[model samples]
Target chain A: MSETVIKFGILGCAEIARKVGRAIGLAPNATIVAVGSRSAEKAAKYAADNGFPPATRAYGSYDAVLDDPEVDAVYVPLPTSLHAKWAVLAAQKKKHLLLEKPVAVNAAEFDKIVEACVANGVQFMDGTMWMHHPRTAKMKEFVSDERAFGKITAMHTCFTFAADPDFLENDIRVKPDLDGLGALGDAGWYCIRSILWANDYELPKTVTALRGPVLNKAGVILSCGASLYWEEGKVATFHCSFVSHLTMDITAVGTKGTLHVHDFVIPFQESEASFSVASESGFDELVTGWVPKPAEHLVNTSLPQEVLMVKEFSSLVGAIKAKGSQPEMKWPIISKKTQLVIDAVKLSIERGFEPVEVVG
Target chain B: MSETVIKFGILGCAEIARKVGRAIGLAPNATIVAVGSRSAEKAAKYAADNGFPPATRAYGSYDAVLDDPEVDAVYVPLPTSLHAKWAVLAAQKKKHLLLEKPVAVNAAEFDKIVEACVANGVQFMDGTMWMHHPRTAKMKEFVSDERAFGKITAMHTCFTFAADPDFLENDIRVKPDLDGLGALGDAGWYCIRSILWANDYELPKTVTALRGPVLNKAGVILSCGASLYWEEGKVATFHCSFVSHLTMDITAVGTKGTLHVHDFVIPFQESEASFSVASESGFDELVTGWVPKPAEHLVNTSLPQEVLMVKEFSSLVGAIKAKGSQPEMKWPIISKKTQLVIDAVKLSIERGFEPVEVVG
Candidate 1:
């Protein structure tokens, strides 16, 4: 019956951890209880630099943070290669897990993490922040409206960022021993998530990587794309790269309407985001111009999407910890589906751009 | 030399011809001198309903319009099946040709039309009106700016319209013996043209149709998509459909910039059009949102794009008529390249979604 505040432990000093740390500070039900790094001095510096509260603990290793009794949840911002190891450990420690994506290098590894969470009765969620944005719900409303959006026919999503020379050469994402999956695991994670999100979380029947994928000498993808086909004629394609300009776009066309968002992965503004939609649009009598032009809809939120994500995860964790409620299954299910598609795309690429059946 | 007005004779009273007739009237140096249909009554009715000038002649047959001495140029709005026959005949009659696109059923037929125009020393331009939009030139300026846009990387275009039940069953676009190519020739033409336009009219090395193209029982494409690959790592994908909501979008990304236009085929407004451009876009600290957000650039025009197309065509025709200037080859060249890609996509679809080498 008492008010519960979820205590979150930071499980690495990765760059993304700084953002998640800020998000923890912003979430009303969440508090940063601990910070950890391989070196105690680095952990202390990260806590100080990210503005951890005075009472927050700094640990010399991820094991120390997971071993903290007061840490109700752990946000794992470690690289993709470390996700399975740390995520399973945190779940075994009975801490609700907020893991970063690509949740693992492949769905098989991710299933182990999911199993650990289920066995421990701990909540699990991936760090796909945009899924928590208010604008996403609003856009989903439009796409689900039968009279407005009708049945979706096709969708295309692209997420690309031009990495600086230093990042391209030395970033963890490009290193096989670190992130391992490279751009496909990083940027393509978001792209596949988006395609699945647009299709109401329905997994496609097959995924075929497009030809001309650029891979580094270490067998890490630098740029790639894939087309996913579903039964009933629904199709989706996505492109993700670390070598193109920063561009995030989603164009979903349905029988009656279309939804277009230019900045989908990261919004143009922190407080508000906009998407354009047109329903039953047609040209004028002379076909010179559209009769009913598409209209832009804006959704505003007081907190950044990352903060909203932390708040949502913490709330789920709080329910399970304080009231013995069952952990939410939707988040992990979505994460597993996203990983499945990513793995299918990688397999398609490895097989010379052939179609790979997506088995659930 | 006296100023010469290029007099246009419309071959066939197709619905699209009404729009072109209006554009011909709007172009300052162009006049609708004749309109012809299979029946003289239909021709007269089309001219009257479409607001042709009182002095415009109505002919019972297309040959009569071509035979008129005052008709310096002809706008061929006939079906695809008849384009080669009518376009070549108009060229042989010493008339400059403004041909409707899918310029022919395939490149072979289109090339024959081109040869006839060359032999007759006639100006040739396809009725791809968007190419003449003032906004298009503005967009080109952004994409071509080395400092602002950087080198092109990838592009995606979509043009779709949900046909009403009546149109789905009876429209000329879906008829096998009429337009034949259906949505690909109609909507896909714009998508291919936009991709080619973004790439500075450079033809791709190969074209591969995406899987699951929806075809009508009549063997006409109802929906389709294709990916084009250039040897220089530039890639493009486009989708066109008659079973989806009306949406025309182009997203072109470069090394340092991105360009997006939602209504590319037909601007939402006749007087002004806008596109969004993001040059050297990046994220702010903490990576919460975009810094230097994409800017919207608007271009205004007194004439609609179609009228501008007519005016540009007439200017070329007038130059040849009044000053004995040679016909410009750029327009025909671009049209041929677009047709070549379309042919390749069709072939790829026929070959069960294999990559088709695009031989220019």
Candidate 2:
């Protein structure tokens, strides 16, 4: 009858971990039990600075947290290069895994991690925070209405942020040894996920990288884009970059309706998010203006999106721990699809922007 | 000295002619003097129904309007296939021409019209009404500021409308002999023009049509999209369809700022239009939301965009007529560039989505 609180272990203190750590503290069914880094002292300092519980332990390495019997879940915000290794080990150790976006460098590597999680019978989910936002649910509801929004015809998304000179030159994202996939993995992941989610998770028939992708001196992608085509005439295109002003946009057009969200990745306000929708819109007699103007719909959330994400992940972990339920396959399936598309885009770019068939 | 009103002759009784005739009436420097159609009765009915001035004349043939000495300028709102024939004739007859969009079936046909205008020293412009909106001037000013917007990184635009079953079956746009280019020339023209405008009128190096374009049984494009790449790494994309809800969007992202306009073709309100701008935007400490959120920029226009287009065209004619000045080359240059890109897209689609080098 007591509350089912899933104890989580914090990964290395990457910048994103600060936000996720705070989210863990805020999630009703989640608690941070330990912090891990290469140096035990650094882990202690990170836990103290990020307001982790006073009793939370500090570990000298990621393996220590995975070995701890008390840590039921591990939130892995480690560099993407380390994901395939650490994620598989975390699952083998019987710990629920909440991996970050771009779940792995590619889907081939992530398949091993998936196998480990299936073998251990532990819940697995990615850290795509926006998917848990209430606004996203509202948008999905509007798009699902058969009469209001008919079959989607096209969707376009872009997520870009201008990185400072120092970050552009020295950040892990731009360094070949660390998160080498760069902006495509960091920003384009959100764009691809949103596109697939809106398309009801239907993988594209072919992925073609757009021409003129920008890359750093070390061959790390700084800016890139790709177009996806489905068999039934649906098309989607996305652009991501570390060389543009912060802009996140998603425009979904259907036979009878259209949906637009300007701040899809991060809302302009934490408590409330809005999207514009126009159903069966047309022009006036003289075609001077729209007859029914698009209207904005606002959805308010009591908790921030990241906290909701943590809460959602923790609930699944709780079900496995307390009720002996099977691991949910939805999150892992979505994560794999996103990674597959990413891999296809990378291949298309590698093959001179040719179309690459997306493998199931 | 009293008033340099450019006496305008409308070349057809098409649905669009009604709007342009009304615009001619509203423009202070323009006046509808005559309307011409295959049937004189239909032309008269169109003129009366559209509120043309009482003294306006109706003619039994398009040639009659071009032959009238009082008609200093002619507004040709005929089908795209008929444009090359009538527009060049109007120019050869010494009438300044305001031709409808997709000025001709392709760039080759439009080039002949341009030649005719040049030979006769006649001012020429296309009927892309939104280009004359005051809001466009404001958008240009914002993107022109290098410090605020930096180098433009990417531009994406779409213009789509759902056609009724009747229109899908019988509309001139869906007919191969009338408007063979279909949605690409109708809706996609605006998208391509908008991209070129935002990119400071520089044409892309190559144009590649996206895969899976929808075509009608008669081989007219019903829905299509293309990606354009510049040599300097600037990329642009556009989609146009007659099978989707009415949606017009333009997202222009630069290194330092982003600009978004949902209703770029037609404003929601005739009197006011607005766009969102975010300059140097970033996230807060927790990355929960934007720090300096995108701001909406409202632009007011006392006159409708169509009326402004008519007035601007009239002013150019008046200058040429009153001072014996040579025709302003800007409008014709823009029209040619737009038509060239349209030709490239059609070629790319025909060549199995191959990248076609854009010809100047």
Candidate 3:
């Protein structure tokens, strides 16, 4: 029972943080002990509503909470541009870190975050939360089981949404000073992650990228595409567009069969995921026989996002508890790889959609 | 009935011509009176098997068919490299000409074909047969009809399929000098056509394109993408890939609703052509509640490739008979516009996917 309890602190009041706040309440072992925001009123309001005790402090500045000894770990839901600075500060204070996706705008910032965590002897994990979902695990299982779809040959993935032009202005997404990579750094990150996970995160032989018509007001790339290669001949293509209506779809076509996924990027309440498998003969009749096998089982994941985060974070905490010092967390390896691939894509786009090799 | 009947002359035994042959047989007002091919053996054998008269002469070259007194109008099915050569020659001979799609590889070639037909005072039609399909007409009506889907916001289209690597040795599609634009030229032309039809043939202001990974034998792009703008306000995007494992889909999203047309590229006999329109409120619901209106009419079209071609060619002949050659036999202005757009796309790919303007 004692080991089941883990204290959590919120460093920012973001829309995503609201979801995480709810998850922490639902998580069996997690407690929201403190809340902070750039605005004191916002911090106090969120703290009171999220079930923190009256004694639980509300801080106007992020530094006060990171300095608080009562908080075991901190969730950094700040803008992508601010992630590196705050994540490093949290690590230096010896607080475990769960930083958000696109860990930093670019590789250099990511390295700073990783270095601070390593030097401070603190645990760090990138909030690449989608992987914590069971459906992701199930997708991998289905692909690897050759009995289901044999000899994987190719995969195509896309994620996009029509974003409001108002939402695009002055946002960190459009600010090149923050090393803005735009769509490729944001939604396209998931596409690359899915591809890498499908292939066991093998380093691609070469990566090629292209960016679509980017309206100045709407940020760089209303759409973007990338092609990746693997050993002994395997190819993957991905596209992300902000100009289209919302969509999330991933598909893998093998020699003997094909696998399809629908509503992949966004999670629905009851039916978030759907997949269909078609054999060669079945493919011949795809126009008629194609059916979306309901992924009802993958929906309403019993464990909330906070619970998954806390549990993974707790493992690092447990290591700290046993050794009297925090061990290196999994964020650096995973985040580093993600940033490297994204950097290569950005380079490729700059070089006129040329193929860029992914080194280190 | 006598007035309804029209005579047709086919210039070759192309794989596509076979489809046209069947369509001619099925059309109410069409008859194949004469057939010609460079190989007398093959042409003579084909004439004997089909219902063409035994006297239908087999020639050693294309010019002989142009010289045939019995030949009225002609269907030209030749290599991608030879379409312009034979088409211009037939037009000069004053034969009503139905030339295959991509009328010529570039805008200049298409212009030459048009000039030749005008000088000879004959009917000229590019065999972009899909325009003849009722479904295409229906799609245009649905998108343009405000009562149907409302104002169109965006359109996405794809047409790609892997081909045999050795296809290039005998296939002019592999040779750039033969006007081969690779995947972007071949199947991509269809995707562009679909978008052009949907958008009412609006000329794009700018086009940004990216060449996909190249294939082994063809050394041409196996995959490609483009982002285009008809105006500052309206935009369209498309993807074409020969390396893909065969997929063809088109979707149009509008202010009030969305329309999805699957298998837009290749509507095989087994393929189902269906579209779903979603209400504004109902669109928010992820599953079943979208209130899908069923579309049950099946065109039951001919499966052979030549079927659509023959139907279109016969229709052109019937128009000439009815209108007495008052510009009724020519391809629509949209055909020329489609070639112009595609030509700009090729330039975009060559310039590393830079945005290219389509000159008015």
Candidate 4:
């Protein structure tokens, strides 16, 4: 407990947990103290396979990790259906929470997790790694510049990956009782989060689900899109799917400038990410081509974005434990807004693709 | 009539006409034989300013230009409201029509223009300049490669330009009786056309207007967006506006590949255009970044796309005039499909953003 490093315990040996486990090790202020799975052998294998330190404990059950007084925080990479249950339990046990996205199946469930965090004075943040990328910050600076970008008019984001047939049928994401929201929860989360980030986290006024959403036999969304409208005429649209090639893009157009990025969910390179921006773009005198073409900006990062996400989350936890500071409210608030939009989109789709008012 | 070159008489001295006039001059098989405006002095000025040949005729009335028996074709850059009238008249005069888009305010009107072209045995093509770009052909080769791209799943296109106050207040595009459809016709035309082009000219089954379209005082849409859905589950969305920074993009995602172009309407340079494509994109072993990032392909062209459009149109006209061949039906068919989608989107907006079935 006297160690300066934030000791982390991950609940469930999900595939994503391995990545986060590495992130915990890479993050300067964090360390993996333990990992838990339903089977002790799976936990041991996951730790051994993912380069967890020899000192890391392999727990037979998630509760064993929660009960470990040495574990300062828990990374919850369990299925969406298990998020509220385990995240709240971890929070009650005084473990700071790093919950995987689609933080919960719905906003109400996320609210329960948030309430637990508040009651137990635990720091909470979702596993939206891209937000911590240095390139994201640089892009935000350009878009927020009044002289350069002016008022935002519209934004569009998309994230899609062609999932293998076996994955589509057997993955927990498609199971109604597991990651019930399917691609909308897994892939759409990034698209929606990017839009909200471009809008400076302002909630949209309404959400309308685009037609022709592909659904699995279990009635889970395989692919879908939605348009979001703000009261001030700023509009955004996003599409996400498990049936298309890997493509992640964010196109935000303001009155004076436009921002374009092809890889927003993950960088094309671990050390660097790039985006293009054009300010006051116009055609040449002859109307043949662009007068001032967009210029690409590359941001270099020493640590991968996921590791940065872990560092940021652990730093907040450190502040709470060391200085008795109140838990950071920003991450949970943003997570709740994203969950709200996701729920609104789902409702709009359920209502025969009608426009659903987004209630903040 | 004995000359091999296609003689083009341009209708009106609009700004776009000057560009097309230069395009006509650039096309090896097309010559600007005449230009007509409401004022003879304006026609003379336009012809002189645009470097038309000394022998080029200047007419005070459009009818005078159409009456010239030597004029084999006419490039109609008049406002949308005048398209059906002038285009049909040009066709009836046995002049091949290179009409500015949105060819007409509606498909029914464009049908009249096409019917006249059919009756008069003259070629018909809308002035969608980018369609003839060599880069477009190259991009098509990649998108159509089944091994590389697989089945088309979704596409999104956007075209927007920040309009000055004068333009918003007084431009012909904002006048209901002039362009009528406003930004939807002026800018959205290219977006819808790009979507149709990506789908290989297959008409969408339905069109749903996205919420939050901005319209001028006269009820002309200044900014708008719509989502088009095909019966086979392919979906496309597009946004066009006169109030955003200049941005023309096409992001087409297939089951196995993705294509991205930033300046699709107009290239960044007159001599070359580039697009990015990724086939079977995957993540690196650690899932940190793309394993093989999208590669950029550049295509060089001696003539700008507008000039290519003129060349293609005149080539069709030349074949008909010299070899006694039938006019190409492909141009009109594609133009009609584009107009049909536009009309459906307009209808959807009028119906309170309901999904309107597109009947081609």
Candidate 5:
């Protein structure tokens, strides 16, 4: 068998794509041989600077990138509003997909994309790098198997950052159609994804939301709160805000114990993350003078998103080549479940918190 | 004219009445002149045993106790379901009233009671004991006036306790018609009351609630969660449970710092409370550090609720004895607002959190 590398083409010169493109370029068995943009000159320039040969493709249109026979996979970093259209077009070309977070603006649109991918027999994976991380799998195993946190009673997740306009022009985050789901889609999805994955992808039985309007900006949500009925008796609440302080924290409370992660999504680059679990009896006895255990460095070393993402993608490509097919693993399952949850949250927001049922 | 102690009468031998009876017996310048119950023997026995002479009167029915000219005031500790009827009757007799907490089941009922009190030209007060405590007034002044906590943004209050069926048997708290408001009417009212009082009587612009049933217990709310919305994007979430492990705590987050009080509502009784404020740049620091404030110890000091009750009631009596035709400067304005907020919370619960427009 020939040791074949996955040839990759990326559409949209999005901020995220720049990092993902670099990742693909560095992947051991992957090559970003093509780049597309709205401007032909810009596309050609990007391809040239990024080591694409003159014979390699440089297209001014999105469809032109998908039309290239040498491109086995397409990385779609387009705005959320454009995610479904591009993913469908790429699937029509029978190319594997790595769509950006949220996958689509809403669940219905995401479903159509999923249907198209399945119909074309193409591999579809939503770009949720965190879920693909080894640490995430460890978290899931601890919560679900080890039962380190007992029967989950409540989970609180927060993701927030100050949005400075000048740096984010035409950013989908401020687009009503693309980002109307607001912080929930932008950052809250991670919390939702984390909770769902930890709970074996048990969809919320009921959901309610509270939304605040963005000030000093049009078509942006300032903050949002969501409550999820995860099971017959367990409930979870999540909050995200663009106008508040920066934070990414997830805490889970259960029958006999509690677990907390201070920074789950974007952990401090130099600071290791500390996790602590205390049982009911342990919590009581240790209250007087409880010394928290030293933090464990989950990542071998700090790396930029582009480097880490490329590392993971290269690993996946290698595994697929070795297996002669997709690795029978959790990534596909995690991505599908995460996108479905993202869609449900958008629906709940639109209906002013009317419960939305999630189905497979 | 000789200064004379005001005589007080109480109808019903409910546990609340027993508490009030002791208060009346020990309150300075007040007398537990008479007692009444459904049974004449029980009424006579209670009156005699509690130091009320036969000359002070004992009656089989509530009206008999009301008609005793020696009883200058009446304490109505009847079930909230029975509050309206007995309060109206007490008002008709021109007797000043000490109505138990949750003055009425709903706003309309509370309005009716207020109207009846006005028509009879008698003083009426809700027995929400917490608000009358000096510490409550001090705390409110610190939070809102001094801004001790600084721009309070969020408040989390939890009140949970195991119910004693022996004490609650046939109690209005367990009676559907009387305590139908559930936790919003019972202990939950205190949570809302505290927030409203602390926030200068600002009514919640929006609210969300989750209620769980108390198994096999009639008219009792086993657990409830309510999130309150305030102007300028502030929020307060409160939880009350009858089935959870006993816990009570209130935490307030503000721009300048945070304040936490454990066992809040009855901190004066069951626990000690401390407040800590962090100094932040560009904000005036008013309160800082964990200062151990004195806890109100009336409940266990054997000083009797009557002593404090009479002290407060005597102020109204003194105002009455003055040249003014009606008692003035007796009832704290905060009490009126607290009642209104309690009514709004009930309306929110019944109407499924529809925004209740509150009159200033």
Candidate 6:
């Protein structure tokens, strides 16, 4: 079982890369071989500050990271607008990709990235760390249990952060040319992913943007919401904002069970996570209170969720390299599904809040 | 404070009547004086079965209870369609009214009932028991605190219960000629009230019903949701259904804080209720976990919420009778606000999911 570690080269010294760099240091099957930024000096400082091994290379450009013979994969944390260019180029250079999310500005752009990955046969995974958390698997089990959860009826999720004045004015997320999709893409990406995950990756039929979405002067969404409808009467709604307090939540209700997780995007603590579930809930005899109250389930993790995400991605890359196996399609498939719904929401918002049929 | 007690007269023996009847027994300032139904035999049995005092009268018709000289107030839990006629008649009889939720099918009917109560000098209060809960007041304090909660930006609430097959077909809530507003009127009533309550009863500028609402064969809404938008970019959404697992929740997000209550309509226990709040929350240095996690605040109640509702109503009635005070307008004002939003949602759904301006 002791295989060669998957060597990773970070594409940018973005703030998120600091966390993922620590994850790579913690992941047994992953190691950083190179770090890249627009300036080699900045890349070297990021690697030094983040405690990458002294032997690690600092590249002046992302192309140098992809060109390195020792780099088995690239972690793309570049601004969303540069995603298609670098992700496709990284794939074409025969390197696997672990891309930060809202994988592309739009689904079509993502499709092109996937096309390149398929052409080069490189593994693909988005940097949604919560998906790798052990607690998420436990939650998925509860929501999928027929006896415990029954048919899923509705779900609500939100991811919001109160951006400071500097962030609101100059952050890449609010810039039309950087993270062009804005809050609807950055914060909303997690909300959409959670909804799809709880629904067992089943895509809803339509997405309708709620009215009164706030936008910056550059026409980038600052806060927004959308409701998704499934033909079987299953509905899900999500809200994402850059102008609200830091709040991450997911509530999924089935015919017989309900699941709630307030820290779906980030756990309260690094070592433990918790969620509440109530099955076959009803009122007491006098209807004064619940008969069987919701029970909180705690999951303790040996490693943080981000570490697990890196480990999982490394294992997949190792499989392709050592076993000559096909790259895992599950991750990109889910990423595409999330992107499709986001595209639908964007279209719905553009169309004066009309219901846009989701193209799966 | 030791003035006369308010003697209550019950309407039909609907299932909810049993719960309120228990609350009346618990409230020191409220007493059951009469029980009324279509048949005298059923009324007598209901009174006996509920352990009513031997001195309490059993009336064959609702009119008899309204005319009872000893009955100072009426607890009208009749089907919604019967509310306009019987509630107005009771008000005209100078009987103070404690009406059940969705006080009438629509605001117009509710307005008529209010008019009758005003003309006859009778106190009017809808039986929204949660409003009287001590926990609700405690939660309100948190949401209202400018330092703790900040300006409210978004809110979401839901009330859903899985109805048995028989209830789906025969329950008064689903019957077109009876409690006809179905889930939107029954479960959704609580959702609307909670949203309005959190926002300090500031009506939303518009209400747009979500698509894919489930309806019964008789055109009664069985499942529905809507998004309410305020002009200042604040928004709220709610979902109600008769076919999902029982879940009552309220999540209010402000610029600096978030409030979450899992059991808003009914507490998990009679003596204790809890809610979670997080103020100025953010991630830790590594972004692996929350810095200041959400803190759970438990509020203990000496009496259940429904008992408090009865006590509050009876105390208001006592002030009117003993001090010749005018009726308190707060309860009716909130009820009217909730009903107005519901009417707007209904209208939006009728207009093919268009945004309906809420006329406060």
lDDT of 4 by residue, A161-196 (tens): 999999998999999999999999999999999999
Q: lDDT values of the candidates?
A: 0.91, 0.93, 0.66, 0.92, 0.61, 0.93
Model 4: how far residue A75 lies from native, Å: 0.4
Worst-scoring 10-residue span by lDDT in model 5 chain B: B281-290
Query: TM-score for model 2?
Result: 0.99
User: Where does candidate 4 clash, by residue pair?
Assistant: none
**Total residue pair clashes for candidate 3:** 3
lDDT of candidate 2 over A1-360, digit per residue (tens): 765999999779899999999999999999999989999999999999989999999999999999999999999999899999999999999999999978998998999999999999988899999999999999999888889988899999999999999999889899888888899999999999999999999999999999989999999999999999997679999999998888899999999999999999899989999999999999999898887899999999999999999999999889988889899999999999999999999899999999999988
The 10 consecutive residues of candidate 3 chain A with the worst lDDT sum are: A281-290
**Per-residue lDDT for B1-360 in model 5, tens only?**
644577788877766566566566666667777777898889887766665645756779999988988777888877788888888888888888888777777666766777777787777776665555454555555566333356665555655444445535655675677666555566777777777765667776766664222323563554566667776657666666443323344555454434444435544231223333332312111111112221222223334233465657755765664544674423534445656666665555567644455664
Give the Å shift of residue A276 in candidate 6.
0.8
Best-first order by lDDT: 6, 2, 4, 1, 3, 5
| lDDT, residue B204, candidate 5 | 69
Which run of 10 residues does model 4 chain B get worst, by summed lDDT? B1-10
Across B279-311, the per-residue lDDT of candidate 3 in tens digits comes to 232223222212332233344443333455555
For model 5, the local distance difference test gives 0.61
Off by over 4 Å in 6: none
Compared with the true structure, what per-residue lDDT tens digits does model 1 show for residues A75-181?
99888888889999999999899999899989999999999999999999999999999999999999999999999999999998999999989999999988888
Tens-digit lDDT track for model 4 on B1-360?
Answer: 444688999999988888888888888888988999998899998899889998899999999999999999999989999998889888888889999999999999998999999999999999999999999999999899999999899999999999899999999999999999999988999999999998889888889999999998799998999999997568999999999999999999999999999998888898999999999989877788786789999999998999989888888888898889999999999999989988998999999999899887
Candidate 5 TM-score for chain A: 0.84
Interface RMSD of 3: 6.3
Model 1: runs farther than 4 Å from truth? none
**Of 2 and 5, which scores higher on TM-score?**
2
TM-scores, each model vs. reference = 0.99, 0.99, 0.78, 0.99, 0.61, 0.99
Candidate 4 - CAPRI tier?
high
| Model 6: residue B301 alpha-carbon error in angstroms | 0.9
Which regions of candidate 4 deviate over 4 angstroms?
A: A1-3, B1-3
Q: State fnat for each of the candidate structures.
A: 0.71, 0.81, 0.05, 0.80, 0.01, 0.79
